[model samples]
Target: MGNTTEVTFFILAAYGDHGQIKYLYFSCLLLLYITICLANIILISLIYVDRSLHEPMYVFLCSLFMNELHGSTTFFSVLLLHILADTHEIAIAYCNVQSFFLHAYGTTEMYNLAVMAYDRYLSICHPLHYSSRMNSCKMYSLIVFTWSFAFFKFVIPMSLRLQLPLCGNIIDKLYCANYALVRLSCQNISLNNILGVFSLVLSVAVPLIPILFSYVNIVRICYKSPKEAQVKALNTCTPQVISLLYFSVSGFFEMVETQFDLTYVPQLIRNVCMVYLFACPQILNPVMYGVRLTKIRNAFKKRFFPNSTE
Candidate 1:
Protein backbone atom coordinates (compact mmCIF):
# COMPACT_ATOMS: atom_id res chain seq x y z
CA MET A 1 0.00 0.00 0.00
CA GLY A 2 2.98 2.27 -0.54
CA ASN A 3 1.62 5.46 -2.08
CA THR A 4 -1.00 3.46 -3.99
CA THR A 5 -2.95 6.66 -4.34
CA GLU A 6 -0.06 8.37 -6.09
CA VAL A 7 -1.08 7.12 -9.52
CA THR A 8 -1.69 10.26 -11.58
CA PHE A 9 -2.37 9.02 -15.11
CA PHE A 10 -3.47 5.90 -16.95
CA ILE A 11 -2.07 4.64 -20.24
CA LEU A 12 -4.57 3.40 -22.82
CA ALA A 13 -3.15 0.14 -24.15
CA ALA A 14 -5.30 -0.68 -27.15
CA TYR A 15 -4.08 2.31 -29.14
CA GLY A 16 -0.60 0.74 -29.29
CA ASP A 17 2.46 2.31 -30.89
CA HIS A 18 1.17 2.54 -34.44
CA GLY A 19 3.67 5.31 -35.26
CA GLN A 20 2.96 6.60 -38.77
CA ILE A 21 -0.45 4.89 -38.85
CA LYS A 22 -1.55 7.35 -36.19
CA TYR A 23 -2.09 9.93 -38.92
CA LEU A 24 -4.40 7.50 -40.68
CA TYR A 25 -6.17 6.83 -37.43
CA PHE A 26 -6.43 10.53 -36.79
CA SER A 27 -7.93 11.22 -40.23
CA CYS A 28 -10.53 8.46 -40.04
CA LEU A 29 -11.39 9.41 -36.50
CA LEU A 30 -11.76 13.06 -37.41
CA LEU A 31 -14.08 12.12 -40.27
CA LEU A 32 -16.24 10.02 -37.97
CA TYR A 33 -16.38 12.66 -35.24
CA ILE A 34 -17.33 15.33 -37.72
CA THR A 35 -19.92 13.12 -39.36
CA ILE A 36 -21.58 12.21 -36.10
CA CYS A 37 -21.60 15.80 -34.95
CA LEU A 38 -22.89 17.27 -38.18
CA ALA A 39 -25.57 14.66 -38.73
CA ASN A 40 -26.97 14.86 -35.23
CA ILE A 41 -26.75 18.62 -35.19
CA ILE A 42 -28.58 19.02 -38.47
CA LEU A 43 -31.33 16.64 -37.40
CA ILE A 44 -31.82 18.51 -34.14
CA SER A 45 -31.78 21.87 -35.86
CA LEU A 46 -34.30 20.77 -38.46
CA ILE A 47 -36.57 19.48 -35.78
CA TYR A 48 -36.32 22.74 -33.88
CA VAL A 49 -37.00 25.01 -36.83
CA ASP A 50 -39.69 23.17 -38.76
CA ARG A 51 -42.97 23.57 -36.93
CA SER A 52 -44.48 20.85 -39.06
CA LEU A 53 -42.00 18.42 -37.54
CA HIS A 54 -42.97 19.37 -33.99
CA GLU A 55 -44.72 16.18 -33.04
CA PRO A 56 -44.16 13.62 -30.29
CA MET A 57 -42.22 11.28 -32.58
CA TYR A 58 -39.92 13.99 -33.90
CA VAL A 59 -39.45 15.38 -30.41
CA PHE A 60 -38.33 11.97 -29.19
CA LEU A 61 -36.04 11.73 -32.19
CA CYS A 62 -34.56 15.07 -31.24
CA SER A 63 -33.84 13.78 -27.75
CA LEU A 64 -32.32 10.64 -29.20
CA PHE A 65 -30.15 12.63 -31.60
CA MET A 66 -28.98 14.84 -28.76
CA ASN A 67 -27.88 11.72 -26.87
CA GLU A 68 -26.02 10.55 -29.94
CA LEU A 69 -24.08 13.78 -29.98
CA HIS A 70 -23.48 13.47 -26.25
CA GLY A 71 -22.15 9.91 -26.49
CA SER A 72 -20.05 10.59 -29.59
CA THR A 73 -18.29 13.55 -28.03
CA THR A 74 -17.75 11.71 -24.76
CA PHE A 75 -15.62 9.00 -26.40
CA PHE A 76 -14.64 9.91 -29.97
CA SER A 77 -13.37 13.42 -29.33
CA VAL A 78 -11.11 12.25 -26.51
CA LEU A 79 -10.07 9.18 -28.50
CA LEU A 80 -9.03 11.43 -31.39
CA LEU A 81 -6.87 13.46 -29.03
CA HIS A 82 -5.13 10.35 -27.63
CA ILE A 83 -4.63 8.81 -31.05
CA LEU A 84 -2.79 11.91 -32.21
CA ALA A 85 -0.78 12.63 -29.06
CA ASP A 86 2.67 11.26 -28.32
CA THR A 87 1.35 9.33 -25.32
CA HIS A 88 -2.00 7.64 -24.98
CA GLU A 89 -2.10 8.64 -21.33
CA ILE A 90 -4.95 10.43 -19.60
CA ALA A 91 -4.86 12.30 -16.32
CA ILE A 92 -6.64 10.62 -13.41
CA ALA A 93 -9.19 13.42 -13.08
CA TYR A 94 -9.96 13.48 -16.80
CA CYS A 95 -10.16 9.70 -16.92
CA ASN A 96 -12.70 9.68 -14.14
CA VAL A 97 -14.83 12.33 -15.85
CA GLN A 98 -14.78 10.43 -19.13
CA SER A 99 -15.69 7.17 -17.42
CA PHE A 100 -18.61 8.81 -15.72
CA PHE A 101 -19.98 10.37 -18.88
CA LEU A 102 -19.50 7.20 -20.91
CA HIS A 103 -21.38 5.10 -18.38
CA ALA A 104 -24.06 7.73 -17.95
CA TYR A 105 -24.43 8.00 -21.68
CA GLY A 106 -25.11 4.29 -21.90
CA THR A 107 -27.95 4.59 -19.42
CA THR A 108 -29.32 7.71 -21.07
CA GLU A 109 -29.27 6.06 -24.47
CA MET A 110 -31.17 2.97 -23.36
CA TYR A 111 -33.92 5.01 -21.74
CA ASN A 112 -34.04 7.34 -24.71
CA LEU A 113 -34.72 4.40 -26.97
CA ALA A 114 -37.30 3.09 -24.54
CA VAL A 115 -39.09 6.43 -24.53
CA MET A 116 -38.99 6.49 -28.31
CA ALA A 117 -40.50 3.02 -28.43
CA TYR A 118 -43.26 4.09 -26.09
CA ASP A 119 -43.93 7.14 -28.24
CA ARG A 120 -44.28 4.97 -31.31
CA TYR A 121 -46.58 2.56 -29.51
CA LEU A 122 -48.85 5.34 -28.39
CA SER A 123 -48.91 6.90 -31.85
CA ILE A 124 -49.89 3.62 -33.48
CA CYS A 125 -51.82 1.79 -30.79
CA HIS A 126 -53.61 4.62 -29.06
CA PRO A 127 -53.65 7.33 -31.64
CA LEU A 128 -56.62 9.18 -30.16
CA HIS A 129 -55.31 9.21 -26.62
CA TYR A 130 -51.65 9.68 -27.57
CA SER A 131 -52.08 13.42 -27.88
CA SER A 132 -53.34 13.65 -24.33
CA ARG A 133 -50.97 11.04 -22.93
CA MET A 134 -47.68 12.28 -24.41
CA ASN A 135 -48.19 16.00 -24.63
CA SER A 136 -45.26 18.41 -24.75
CA CYS A 137 -45.22 18.73 -20.98
CA LYS A 138 -45.16 14.98 -20.35
CA MET A 139 -42.70 14.43 -23.17
CA TYR A 140 -40.25 17.00 -21.81
CA SER A 141 -40.67 15.60 -18.33
CA LEU A 142 -39.79 12.14 -19.56
CA ILE A 143 -36.72 13.48 -21.36
CA VAL A 144 -35.55 15.33 -18.29
CA PHE A 145 -36.10 12.27 -16.11
CA THR A 146 -34.05 10.05 -18.42
CA TRP A 147 -31.14 12.46 -18.50
CA SER A 148 -31.29 13.18 -14.78
CA PHE A 149 -31.61 9.53 -13.87
CA ALA A 150 -28.55 8.65 -15.91
CA PHE A 151 -26.57 11.63 -14.68
CA PHE A 152 -26.87 10.64 -11.03
CA LYS A 153 -27.14 6.85 -11.30
CA PHE A 154 -23.39 6.17 -11.47
CA VAL A 155 -22.32 8.61 -8.80
CA ILE A 156 -22.14 6.11 -5.96
CA PRO A 157 -20.15 3.60 -7.99
CA MET A 158 -17.74 6.26 -9.18
CA SER A 159 -17.36 7.54 -5.64
CA LEU A 160 -16.68 4.00 -4.45
CA ARG A 161 -13.88 3.55 -7.00
CA LEU A 162 -12.37 6.96 -6.27
CA GLN A 163 -11.94 5.93 -2.64
CA LEU A 164 -9.93 2.83 -3.62
CA PRO A 165 -6.14 3.03 -3.61
CA LEU A 166 -4.95 2.27 -7.10
CA CYS A 167 -1.72 0.36 -7.58
CA GLY A 168 -1.88 0.44 -11.38
CA ASN A 169 -2.79 3.04 -13.98
CA ILE A 170 -3.05 1.03 -17.14
CA ILE A 171 -6.46 0.86 -18.86
CA ASP A 172 -6.54 -1.75 -21.64
CA LYS A 173 -9.22 -0.11 -23.74
CA LEU A 174 -8.80 2.99 -25.89
CA TYR A 175 -10.97 4.86 -23.40
CA CYS A 176 -11.44 5.04 -19.66
CA ALA A 177 -13.91 2.29 -18.85
CA ASN A 178 -15.41 2.60 -15.35
CA TYR A 179 -15.05 -1.10 -14.55
CA ALA A 180 -11.58 -1.21 -16.01
CA LEU A 181 -10.70 1.72 -13.80
CA VAL A 182 -12.18 -0.14 -10.82
CA ARG A 183 -10.09 -3.21 -11.67
CA LEU A 184 -6.90 -1.18 -11.31
CA SER A 185 -7.54 -0.66 -7.59
CA CYS A 186 -5.08 -2.49 -5.36
CA GLN A 187 -7.66 -2.62 -2.54
CA ASN A 188 -10.74 -4.76 -2.17
CA ILE A 189 -13.33 -3.97 -4.86
CA SER A 190 -16.11 -6.30 -3.71
CA LEU A 191 -18.49 -3.45 -3.08
CA ASN A 192 -17.65 -1.85 -6.37
CA ASN A 193 -18.20 -5.08 -8.27
CA ILE A 194 -21.47 -5.85 -6.54
CA LEU A 195 -22.81 -2.37 -7.15
CA GLY A 196 -21.58 -2.49 -10.72
CA VAL A 197 -23.50 -5.70 -11.38
CA PHE A 198 -26.63 -4.29 -9.77
CA SER A 199 -26.35 -1.04 -11.70
CA LEU A 200 -25.79 -2.95 -14.92
CA VAL A 201 -28.96 -4.94 -14.45
CA LEU A 202 -31.01 -1.87 -13.64
CA SER A 203 -29.63 0.24 -16.46
CA VAL A 204 -30.20 -2.46 -19.06
CA ALA A 205 -33.38 -4.09 -17.80
CA VAL A 206 -35.41 -1.15 -16.55
CA PRO A 207 -35.44 0.74 -19.83
CA LEU A 208 -36.16 -2.55 -21.58
CA ILE A 209 -39.51 -2.88 -19.85
CA PRO A 210 -41.05 -0.05 -21.85
CA ILE A 211 -39.27 -1.05 -25.05
CA LEU A 212 -40.38 -4.67 -24.84
CA PHE A 213 -43.94 -3.83 -23.83
CA SER A 214 -44.31 -1.20 -26.52
CA TYR A 215 -42.96 -3.37 -29.31
CA VAL A 216 -44.96 -6.42 -28.24
CA ASN A 217 -48.12 -4.35 -28.27
CA ILE A 218 -47.19 -2.73 -31.57
CA VAL A 219 -46.65 -6.18 -33.10
CA ARG A 220 -49.83 -7.60 -31.66
CA ILE A 221 -51.84 -4.60 -32.78
CA CYS A 222 -50.44 -4.95 -36.27
CA TYR A 223 -51.19 -8.65 -36.32
CA LYS A 224 -54.90 -7.99 -35.91
CA SER A 225 -55.18 -4.75 -37.90
CA PRO A 226 -56.08 -4.49 -41.57
CA LYS A 227 -53.38 -4.74 -44.25
CA GLU A 228 -53.38 -1.00 -44.82
CA ALA A 229 -53.23 -0.36 -41.11
CA GLN A 230 -50.44 -2.92 -40.70
CA VAL A 231 -48.44 -1.32 -43.49
CA LYS A 232 -48.97 2.10 -41.94
CA ALA A 233 -47.85 0.84 -38.54
CA LEU A 234 -44.80 -0.82 -40.05
CA ASN A 235 -43.86 2.34 -41.87
CA THR A 236 -44.33 4.43 -38.75
CA CYS A 237 -42.27 2.19 -36.53
CA THR A 238 -39.48 1.12 -38.87
CA PRO A 239 -36.97 3.67 -37.62
CA GLN A 240 -37.62 2.88 -33.97
CA VAL A 241 -37.51 -0.85 -34.62
CA ILE A 242 -34.20 -0.55 -36.45
CA SER A 243 -32.76 1.65 -33.74
CA LEU A 244 -33.91 -0.73 -31.00
CA LEU A 245 -32.50 -3.82 -32.67
CA TYR A 246 -29.22 -2.13 -33.54
CA PHE A 247 -28.89 -0.79 -30.01
CA SER A 248 -29.62 -4.20 -28.46
CA VAL A 249 -27.04 -5.98 -30.63
CA SER A 250 -24.35 -3.38 -30.07
CA GLY A 251 -25.10 -3.27 -26.35
CA PHE A 252 -24.81 -7.07 -26.11
CA PHE A 253 -21.41 -7.01 -27.80
CA GLU A 254 -20.29 -4.20 -25.50
CA MET A 255 -21.38 -6.15 -22.43
CA VAL A 256 -19.55 -9.26 -23.59
CA GLU A 257 -16.45 -7.33 -24.55
CA THR A 258 -16.23 -5.59 -21.22
CA GLN A 259 -17.28 -8.46 -18.94
CA PHE A 260 -15.62 -11.50 -20.53
CA ASP A 261 -12.14 -12.48 -21.65
CA LEU A 262 -11.94 -12.56 -25.41
CA THR A 263 -8.21 -12.94 -25.83
CA TYR A 264 -8.63 -15.46 -28.64
CA VAL A 265 -10.20 -12.88 -30.93
CA PRO A 266 -8.07 -10.69 -33.12
CA GLN A 267 -6.99 -7.46 -31.47
CA LEU A 268 -8.45 -5.42 -34.33
CA ILE A 269 -11.83 -7.16 -34.05
CA ARG A 270 -11.92 -6.68 -30.32
CA ASN A 271 -11.07 -3.02 -30.68
CA VAL A 272 -13.70 -2.54 -33.38
CA CYS A 273 -16.23 -4.30 -31.21
CA MET A 274 -15.48 -1.90 -28.38
CA VAL A 275 -15.89 1.35 -30.32
CA TYR A 276 -18.69 0.19 -32.60
CA LEU A 277 -21.25 0.62 -29.85
CA PHE A 278 -20.65 4.37 -29.73
CA ALA A 279 -19.87 5.11 -33.35
CA CYS A 280 -22.32 2.96 -35.31
CA PRO A 281 -25.49 4.22 -33.67
CA GLN A 282 -24.57 7.88 -33.87
CA ILE A 283 -23.74 7.52 -37.53
CA LEU A 284 -26.74 5.45 -38.59
CA ASN A 285 -29.66 6.77 -36.57
CA PRO A 286 -29.90 10.19 -38.20
CA VAL A 287 -29.47 8.81 -41.70
CA MET A 288 -31.99 6.03 -41.10
CA TYR A 289 -34.72 8.25 -39.67
CA GLY A 290 -34.10 11.06 -42.16
CA VAL A 291 -34.59 8.69 -45.06
CA ARG A 292 -37.17 6.27 -43.70
CA LEU A 293 -39.50 8.87 -42.25
CA THR A 294 -40.97 10.44 -45.34
CA LYS A 295 -42.10 13.57 -43.51
CA ILE A 296 -38.60 14.25 -42.22
CA ARG A 297 -37.07 13.62 -45.64
CA ASN A 298 -39.60 15.84 -47.35
CA ALA A 299 -39.28 18.53 -44.74
CA PHE A 300 -35.49 18.61 -45.05
CA LYS A 301 -35.65 18.59 -48.82
CA LYS A 302 -38.18 21.39 -48.78
CA ARG A 303 -36.05 23.40 -46.43
CA PHE A 304 -32.92 23.00 -48.55
CA PHE A 305 -34.23 22.52 -52.04
CA PRO A 306 -37.69 23.99 -52.05
CA ASN A 307 -37.87 24.53 -55.79
CA SER A 308 -37.35 20.90 -56.70
CA THR A 309 -40.51 18.93 -57.41
CA GLU A 310 -40.73 15.48 -55.87
Candidate 2:
Protein backbone atom coordinates (compact mmCIF):
# COMPACT_ATOMS: atom_id res chain seq x y z
CA MET A 1 0.00 0.00 0.00
CA GLY A 2 1.10 3.55 -0.68
CA ASN A 3 2.10 5.71 2.24
CA THR A 4 -0.56 8.30 1.44
CA THR A 5 -4.07 7.93 2.89
CA GLU A 6 -7.11 8.94 0.85
CA VAL A 7 -9.57 10.67 3.15
CA THR A 8 -11.95 13.22 1.72
CA PHE A 9 -14.17 14.41 4.55
CA PHE A 10 -14.91 13.91 8.26
CA ILE A 11 -18.26 13.60 9.96
CA LEU A 12 -18.39 15.12 13.45
CA ALA A 13 -20.25 12.80 15.79
CA ALA A 14 -20.75 15.53 18.41
CA TYR A 15 -22.98 17.44 16.06
CA GLY A 16 -26.35 16.37 17.42
CA ASP A 17 -29.08 15.35 14.98
CA HIS A 18 -31.77 17.25 16.77
CA GLY A 19 -34.49 17.67 14.16
CA GLN A 20 -36.70 20.08 16.10
CA ILE A 21 -34.09 21.42 18.53
CA LYS A 22 -31.65 22.42 15.81
CA TYR A 23 -32.97 25.95 15.71
CA LEU A 24 -32.49 26.32 19.43
CA TYR A 25 -28.93 25.04 19.10
CA PHE A 26 -28.20 27.45 16.27
CA SER A 27 -29.66 30.40 18.16
CA CYS A 28 -27.65 29.63 21.28
CA LEU A 29 -24.41 29.20 19.36
CA LEU A 30 -24.99 32.39 17.41
CA LEU A 31 -25.62 34.27 20.63
CA LEU A 32 -22.43 32.85 22.18
CA TYR A 33 -20.32 33.69 19.13
CA ILE A 34 -21.67 37.23 19.12
CA THR A 35 -20.99 37.70 22.82
CA ILE A 36 -17.39 36.50 22.50
CA CYS A 37 -16.78 38.87 19.59
CA LEU A 38 -18.32 41.84 21.35
CA ALA A 39 -16.45 41.25 24.61
CA ASN A 40 -13.05 40.83 22.97
CA ILE A 41 -13.59 43.74 20.57
CA ILE A 42 -14.66 46.05 23.35
CA LEU A 43 -11.73 45.00 25.55
CA ILE A 44 -9.29 45.46 22.68
CA SER A 45 -10.71 48.91 21.93
CA LEU A 46 -10.59 49.93 25.56
CA ILE A 47 -6.89 49.18 25.72
CA TYR A 48 -6.11 50.86 22.40
CA VAL A 49 -7.88 54.18 23.00
CA ASP A 50 -6.68 54.77 26.52
CA ARG A 51 -3.11 55.99 26.55
CA SER A 52 -2.76 55.21 30.25
CA LEU A 53 -3.57 51.56 29.59
CA HIS A 54 -0.63 50.95 27.25
CA GLU A 55 1.47 49.35 30.00
CA PRO A 56 2.71 45.75 29.98
CA MET A 57 -0.15 44.17 31.96
CA TYR A 58 -2.79 45.75 29.75
CA VAL A 59 -0.81 44.80 26.69
CA PHE A 60 -0.84 41.15 27.78
CA LEU A 61 -4.57 41.42 28.50
CA CYS A 62 -5.14 42.77 25.00
CA SER A 63 -3.21 39.88 23.51
CA LEU A 64 -5.20 37.40 25.59
CA PHE A 65 -8.49 38.82 24.33
CA MET A 66 -7.26 38.65 20.74
CA ASN A 67 -6.20 35.03 21.21
CA GLU A 68 -9.63 34.22 22.58
CA LEU A 69 -11.16 35.81 19.49
CA HIS A 70 -8.91 33.85 17.14
CA GLY A 71 -9.56 30.53 18.93
CA SER A 72 -13.33 30.98 19.09
CA THR A 73 -13.56 32.21 15.52
CA THR A 74 -11.60 29.19 14.30
CA PHE A 75 -14.06 26.79 15.90
CA PHE A 76 -17.36 28.68 15.70
CA SER A 77 -17.25 30.10 12.18
CA VAL A 78 -16.98 26.57 10.80
CA LEU A 79 -19.21 25.24 13.57
CA LEU A 80 -22.03 27.66 12.85
CA LEU A 81 -22.01 26.67 9.20
CA HIS A 82 -21.98 22.98 10.06
CA ILE A 83 -24.93 23.57 12.34
CA LEU A 84 -27.03 24.99 9.54
CA ALA A 85 -26.03 22.45 6.89
CA ASP A 86 -27.90 19.22 6.23
CA THR A 87 -24.73 17.14 6.46
CA HIS A 88 -22.24 17.89 9.21
CA GLU A 89 -19.02 17.13 7.37
CA ILE A 90 -15.73 19.01 7.00
CA ALA A 91 -13.20 18.64 4.20
CA ILE A 92 -10.01 16.90 5.31
CA ALA A 93 -7.67 19.72 4.34
CA TYR A 94 -9.86 22.25 6.10
CA CYS A 95 -10.06 19.99 9.12
CA ASN A 96 -6.29 19.82 9.33
CA VAL A 97 -6.05 23.59 9.04
CA GLN A 98 -8.62 24.10 11.78
CA SER A 99 -6.86 21.64 14.04
CA PHE A 100 -3.58 23.51 13.64
CA PHE A 101 -5.09 26.89 14.47
CA LEU A 102 -7.01 25.54 17.44
CA HIS A 103 -3.92 23.84 18.87
CA ALA A 104 -2.01 27.06 18.27
CA TYR A 105 -4.69 28.86 20.22
CA GLY A 106 -4.33 26.50 23.19
CA THR A 107 -0.55 26.77 23.35
CA THR A 108 -0.56 30.53 22.80
CA GLU A 109 -3.04 31.12 25.58
CA MET A 110 -0.97 29.08 28.04
CA TYR A 111 2.21 31.00 27.24
CA ASN A 112 0.37 34.30 27.49
CA LEU A 113 -0.90 33.38 30.94
CA ALA A 114 2.59 32.34 32.01
CA VAL A 115 3.90 35.73 30.88
CA MET A 116 1.18 37.46 32.85
CA ALA A 117 2.09 35.43 35.90
CA TYR A 118 5.71 36.49 35.58
CA ASP A 119 4.64 40.12 35.29
CA ARG A 120 2.58 39.88 38.46
CA TYR A 121 5.39 38.12 40.24
CA LEU A 122 7.79 40.93 39.44
CA SER A 123 5.37 43.66 40.37
CA ILE A 124 4.38 42.13 43.68
CA CYS A 125 7.34 40.10 44.82
CA HIS A 126 10.10 42.37 43.58
CA PRO A 127 8.50 45.78 43.31
CA LEU A 128 11.80 47.67 43.29
CA HIS A 129 13.16 45.74 40.28
CA TYR A 130 9.85 45.31 38.44
CA SER A 131 10.29 48.40 36.25
CA SER A 132 13.82 47.51 35.14
CA ARG A 133 12.93 43.83 34.80
CA MET A 134 9.87 44.08 32.55
CA ASN A 135 10.75 46.99 30.33
CA SER A 136 9.29 47.74 26.89
CA CYS A 137 11.93 45.85 24.93
CA LYS A 138 11.70 42.82 27.21
CA MET A 139 7.90 42.87 27.07
CA TYR A 140 7.77 42.87 23.29
CA SER A 141 10.37 40.13 23.15
CA LEU A 142 8.30 37.97 25.52
CA ILE A 143 5.18 38.49 23.41
CA VAL A 144 7.06 37.48 20.24
CA PHE A 145 8.47 34.44 21.99
CA THR A 146 5.00 33.35 23.13
CA TRP A 147 3.61 33.22 19.60
CA SER A 148 6.78 31.78 18.06
CA PHE A 149 7.03 28.96 20.60
CA ALA A 150 3.38 27.91 20.20
CA PHE A 151 3.57 27.92 16.38
CA PHE A 152 6.72 25.80 16.18
CA LYS A 153 5.56 23.34 18.85
CA PHE A 154 2.52 22.25 16.84
CA VAL A 155 3.99 22.46 13.33
CA ILE A 156 6.12 19.33 13.76
CA PRO A 157 3.40 17.13 15.24
CA MET A 158 0.85 18.43 12.76
CA SER A 159 3.07 17.66 9.78
CA LEU A 160 3.62 14.14 11.08
CA ARG A 161 -0.16 13.68 11.61
CA LEU A 162 -1.03 14.68 8.06
CA GLN A 163 1.10 11.82 6.67
CA LEU A 164 -0.75 9.09 8.57
CA PRO A 165 -3.23 6.79 6.81
CA LEU A 166 -6.46 7.56 8.62
CA CYS A 167 -8.55 4.46 9.23
CA GLY A 168 -11.74 6.44 9.76
CA ASN A 169 -13.13 9.79 8.70
CA ILE A 170 -15.31 10.60 11.70
CA ILE A 171 -14.30 12.66 14.74
CA ASP A 172 -16.21 12.37 18.00
CA LYS A 173 -16.00 16.01 18.85
CA LEU A 174 -17.39 19.33 17.72
CA TYR A 175 -14.07 20.32 16.20
CA CYS A 176 -10.73 19.02 15.01
CA ALA A 177 -7.93 18.48 17.52
CA ASN A 178 -4.52 17.04 16.64
CA TYR A 179 -5.06 13.99 18.83
CA ALA A 180 -8.59 13.48 17.54
CA LEU A 181 -7.25 13.43 14.00
CA VAL A 182 -4.37 11.14 15.01
CA ARG A 183 -6.72 8.69 16.71
CA LEU A 184 -8.37 8.09 13.34
CA SER A 185 -5.14 6.93 11.74
CA CYS A 186 -5.05 3.30 10.54
CA GLN A 187 -1.33 2.53 10.64
CA ASN A 188 0.79 2.07 13.74
CA ILE A 189 0.77 5.45 15.45
CA SER A 190 3.52 4.77 17.95
CA LEU A 191 5.59 7.64 16.60
CA ASN A 192 2.54 9.85 16.40
CA ASN A 193 1.58 8.92 19.96
CA ILE A 194 5.05 9.71 21.21
CA LEU A 195 5.04 13.06 19.44
CA GLY A 196 1.54 13.79 20.63
CA VAL A 197 2.47 13.12 24.29
CA PHE A 198 5.60 15.22 23.99
CA SER A 199 3.64 18.04 22.39
CA LEU A 200 1.01 17.96 25.12
CA VAL A 201 3.65 18.12 27.85
CA LEU A 202 5.55 20.95 26.21
CA SER A 203 2.38 22.88 25.58
CA VAL A 204 0.82 22.45 29.02
CA ALA A 205 3.62 21.73 31.46
CA VAL A 206 6.25 24.20 30.24
CA PRO A 207 4.01 27.22 30.73
CA LEU A 208 1.98 25.90 33.66
CA ILE A 209 4.96 24.97 35.83
CA PRO A 210 6.31 28.51 35.64
CA ILE A 211 2.91 29.95 36.45
CA LEU A 212 2.60 27.82 39.57
CA PHE A 213 6.11 28.71 40.66
CA SER A 214 5.45 32.42 40.17
CA TYR A 215 2.24 32.27 42.19
CA VAL A 216 3.96 30.36 44.96
CA ASN A 217 6.53 33.12 45.29
CA ILE A 218 3.83 35.77 45.04
CA VAL A 219 1.88 34.16 47.87
CA ARG A 220 4.98 33.90 50.02
CA ILE A 221 5.77 37.57 49.47
CA CYS A 222 2.20 38.56 50.22
CA TYR A 223 2.40 36.78 53.54
CA LYS A 224 5.60 38.60 54.50
CA SER A 225 4.47 42.06 53.30
CA PRO A 226 2.41 44.68 55.11
CA LYS A 227 -1.39 44.57 55.14
CA GLU A 228 -1.75 47.37 52.58
CA ALA A 229 0.70 45.70 50.25
CA GLN A 230 -1.10 42.40 50.61
CA VAL A 231 -4.42 44.01 49.68
CA LYS A 232 -2.88 45.72 46.68
CA ALA A 233 -1.33 42.47 45.49
CA LEU A 234 -4.60 40.64 45.89
CA ASN A 235 -6.53 43.28 43.98
CA THR A 236 -4.21 43.16 40.99
CA CYS A 237 -3.64 39.41 40.94
CA THR A 238 -7.11 38.03 41.82
CA PRO A 239 -8.46 38.06 38.27
CA GLN A 240 -5.42 36.34 36.86
CA VAL A 241 -5.51 33.68 39.56
CA ILE A 242 -9.19 33.11 38.79
CA SER A 243 -8.52 32.87 35.07
CA LEU A 244 -5.78 30.34 35.72
CA LEU A 245 -8.00 28.28 38.01
CA TYR A 246 -10.80 28.17 35.44
CA PHE A 247 -8.43 27.10 32.69
CA SER A 248 -6.86 24.42 34.87
CA VAL A 249 -10.18 22.92 35.99
CA SER A 250 -11.90 23.07 32.62
CA GLY A 251 -8.85 21.77 30.77
CA PHE A 252 -8.42 18.91 33.27
CA PHE A 253 -12.02 17.80 32.88
CA GLU A 254 -11.75 17.86 29.09
CA MET A 255 -8.57 15.81 29.14
CA VAL A 256 -10.08 13.29 31.55
CA GLU A 257 -13.20 12.91 29.41
CA THR A 258 -11.08 12.38 26.34
CA GLN A 259 -8.89 9.70 27.98
CA PHE A 260 -11.54 7.73 29.89
CA ASP A 261 -14.82 6.06 29.02
CA LEU A 262 -17.42 8.75 29.58
CA THR A 263 -20.14 6.86 27.74
CA TYR A 264 -21.94 6.29 31.03
CA VAL A 265 -22.46 10.02 31.33
CA PRO A 266 -25.42 11.64 29.59
CA GLN A 267 -24.58 12.95 26.15
CA LEU A 268 -25.92 16.41 26.95
CA ILE A 269 -23.75 16.71 30.07
CA ARG A 270 -20.69 15.36 28.29
CA ASN A 271 -21.30 17.65 25.37
CA VAL A 272 -21.67 20.65 27.65
CA CYS A 273 -18.41 19.79 29.43
CA MET A 274 -16.62 19.45 26.09
CA VAL A 275 -17.79 22.79 24.70
CA TYR A 276 -17.10 24.50 28.03
CA LEU A 277 -13.40 23.86 27.51
CA PHE A 278 -13.52 26.20 24.51
CA ALA A 279 -16.24 28.56 25.69
CA CYS A 280 -15.28 29.18 29.33
CA PRO A 281 -11.89 30.78 28.70
CA GLN A 282 -13.24 33.07 26.00
CA ILE A 283 -16.09 34.24 28.18
CA LEU A 284 -14.34 34.16 31.55
CA ASN A 285 -11.17 36.01 30.57
CA PRO A 286 -12.78 39.26 29.50
CA VAL A 287 -15.53 39.38 32.07
CA MET A 288 -13.19 38.43 34.89
CA TYR A 289 -10.62 41.02 33.82
CA GLY A 290 -13.19 43.73 33.20
CA VAL A 291 -14.84 43.33 36.56
CA ARG A 292 -11.87 42.43 38.73
CA LEU A 293 -9.28 44.84 37.37
CA THR A 294 -10.13 48.36 38.35
CA LYS A 295 -8.05 49.98 35.64
CA ILE A 296 -9.80 48.19 32.79
CA ARG A 297 -13.21 48.84 34.32
CA ASN A 298 -12.37 52.51 34.75
CA ALA A 299 -11.01 52.71 31.22
CA PHE A 300 -14.29 51.36 29.90
CA LYS A 301 -16.27 53.81 31.97
CA LYS A 302 -14.19 56.83 30.97
CA ARG A 303 -14.34 55.94 27.27
CA PHE A 304 -18.03 55.07 27.13
CA PHE A 305 -19.73 57.06 29.90
CA PRO A 306 -17.45 59.94 30.73
CA ASN A 307 -20.26 61.87 32.38
CA SER A 308 -20.93 59.29 35.08
CA THR A 309 -19.14 59.30 38.44
CA GLU A 310 -19.52 56.64 41.12
Which candidate number would show the highest TM-score if scored against the true structure?
A: 1
Collision count of model 2: 0
lDDT of 2 by residue, 1-310 (tens): 3344578999988777778777888899899989999999999999988999999999999989999998889988787887778888999889988989988888898899999999999988888998899999999999999988888888888888888887688787888877888877777888988987798898899998889999999999999999999998999888888888887787788677766667788777877876787787898889989998888889899989999998
Tens digits of per-residue lDDT, candidate 1, 1-310, equal 4347578889998887778998997899789889999999999999999999999889889999999999899998678888888888899889999999989888998999899889989988898999899999999999999999998999899998888898888877888888888878787888998999989987999989999999999999999999999998898788887887887898888777777777788878878877788899999999999988988998999899999998
lDDT of every predicted structure (CA atoms): 0.88, 0.86
Q: What is the lDDT of residue 49 in candidate 1?
A: 97
| Clashing pairs counted in every model | 0, 0
Candidate 2: worst-modelled 10 consecutive residues by lDDT: 1-10
Query: Can you list the residue pairs that collide in candidate 2?
Result: none
Give each model a TM-score: 0.96, 0.96
Model 2 misplaced regions, further than 4 Å: 1-5
Please report the TM-score between candidate 1 and the true structure.
0.96
